[model samples]
Target: MDAASWDERYRGAELVWTAGPNRFVEEELAGLPVGRAVDLGAGEGRNALWLAERGWEVDAVDFSAVALDKAGRLAAERGVGLLRTVCADLTGWSAPEAPYDLALIAYLHLPWPQMAQVLRRAASAVRPGGTLLLVGHDAANLEHGHGGPQDPRVLYTAEQIAELWRPYADVLRAEAVTRPVTDADGSHAAVVVLVRAVRK
Candidate 1:
């Protein structure tokens, strides 16, 4: 969707996504030391706010102005002072050099080439020894899992992401992980590709 479309989607009083951080984001990053971070495609800023509350200075970048506004308001409500929201299209946005200790990309679906560009830029923003983490619906999710985009062009595998990060960082973990998803029918598993790496 375009920025205007996303802005319209976010115009509702309620948040589109959950207010809390993504499950995998918290599970993987909870123990990391506090430092400067950037949450690319940071929808409503849940992850950025969480990092800010934990003493990390975070830049939450998203294309939707409405979403960023909601994020800013939530940060104030939570007394989180270290979060900054930037409105920009990730396809053309550039991260400020290798200054961040951590870079997060969660559930941002785009075409393969554009995604590669964004991920590479995100990786470049991380300083040496810093971390880059990505989590999104795996390609296998369409047939073998539940609840995610069904488009095969956008969905990717862990290996594809791992290969992209190899030149810039040392891959630490790369796999398709299953998470529980509960609906009216009960609990079901949803497969997601997760990649974590440390900059060389």
Candidate 2:
């Protein structure tokens, strides 16, 4: 969805995202040192807020004004004001150059060239010896998963992610993973592609 679509979508009476950070974000970053970080496509700032709570100075970048407003409310409620919210399209944006200890994107899916370029920008934002991570619904999820976008152009595979991120950083791990999910419908699994790397 575009910014206007997301803005309209988030203009709901309720918050669109969950209260806390995404599971993969928490898991992958659990042991990483808290420092300057950026959460690209940080809808509602859940991950950014989480980082702030843990002592990281964070930049929460998203294009949706509605989501940023909700993120502000959430930050206030959680007593967290360490996040900087940037409402910019990532295609034309580059995260600050090599100044961050960590850079991450969660569930931000774009078509191939844009996605690749964004990943490059994300990597460039990371300082040497710092980390970069990306998590998104796996392309294979279309056949086996329950939620997430259905467009293959935006979906990605483990191999595809590895290829994109390799030239920019030293990959710690790259894989298609499965997570258990339970809702009113039933218990099931969702597939995701995860990339963890350190800037070279």
Candidate 3:
């Protein structure tokens, strides 16, 4: 979706996503060394706010201005002064040269070369030995799991992400992880691809 579409989605009063960071994000990053971090496609800045609360200087980037505005307001309300929001299209966005200890791309789905392009941009942001973590709905989730984007074009596999990162980083973990979900349709498991790499 474009910025306008996302803006419309975020225009409602209630939060679109959960108020807290993604489960995988908190679990994987809680023990890592805290430093500069960036949350790409940061809808409403949940992960960014969490990082700020934990004392990491965070840049939350998203295309939607409305989402960024909401994030800014929440940061002020919670006194999280370290969170910064950037409104830009990720495909055309570039981070400062090797400035971050960690770069996170969560649930940001795009097709093919665009996905590769964004991944390259994100990888470029991490200093050597810094971490790059990506999480997204797995392609398998469409038929075997539950509740994610229905479009297969945007869904990806763990191996695919790891392969894309091969030139710039060393893969630490790459797998399809299952999480329990309880929606109105009853209990189900959502499969998501999780990949962690360290910049070379």
Candidate 4:
């Protein structure tokens, strides 16, 4: 969807997504050292707020100002105040001035070319030895997962992600992981792929 579309969607009171960090984000980053981090397409700042609570200074970027406002309020209500919110389109946005220890891009669906470009830029934002983590609806999500963007052009595979990051980083892990996803009917189904890499 375009920025205008997303803005209107988030302008409503439905809470576009759950108010919790993705399970893969929690699992992969749990034991890592806290440091400067960035959450791209950080809708509602779930991952960003979670990182701040864990002692990481976070920069949360999204195109929708409405979502950022909601995220800011959520951070304040949680009593953890380390998040910096930025409203910008990822396709044209630049990274933070300083290198980050970790960069997270979770469920930020975009066209294949755009996704490749953005992921490459995100990889560059990490410092040497820093980590770059990505978790999103795998291409299989359309067939096996219950919820996510219906367009396959935005969905990715492990192989595609590996190619996206291979030029600038060493992929520490690139694999398709099955995680349980509950449908509107409350039926459980498997969804998502989790890919991670460390700056070289």
* Candidate 2 Cα errors over 4 Å, as ranges: none
Q: Per-residue CA lDDT of candidate 2, range 28-80, in tens?
A: 99899889999999999889999999999999999998898888888888888
**Ranking of all candidate structures by their TM-score, best first:** 3, 1, 2, 4
Q: Write the per-residue lDDT of candidate 4 for residues 86-149, one digit (tens) a residue.
A: 9999999888679999999998999999888899889999998999999988899889777778
Question: How high is the CA lDDT of each candidate model?
Answer: 0.94, 0.89, 0.94, 0.89
Which TM-score value belongs to model 1? Answer: 0.97
How big is the positional error of residue 187 in model 1, measured in Å on the Cα after superposition?
A: 2.4
Q: What is the C-alpha RMSD of each candidate to the true structure, in Å?
A: 1.1, 1.2, 0.9, 1.3
TM-score of each: 0.97, 0.96, 0.97, 0.95
Cα RMSD (Å) between model 2 and the true structure? 1.2
Whichever of 2 and 3 has more TM-score, that candidate is 3
Tell me the lDDT of model 1 at 60: 98
What's the residue-level lDDT of 74 in candidate 3?
93
Better of 1 and 2 by lDDT: 1
Worst 10 residues of 1 by lDDT: 91-100
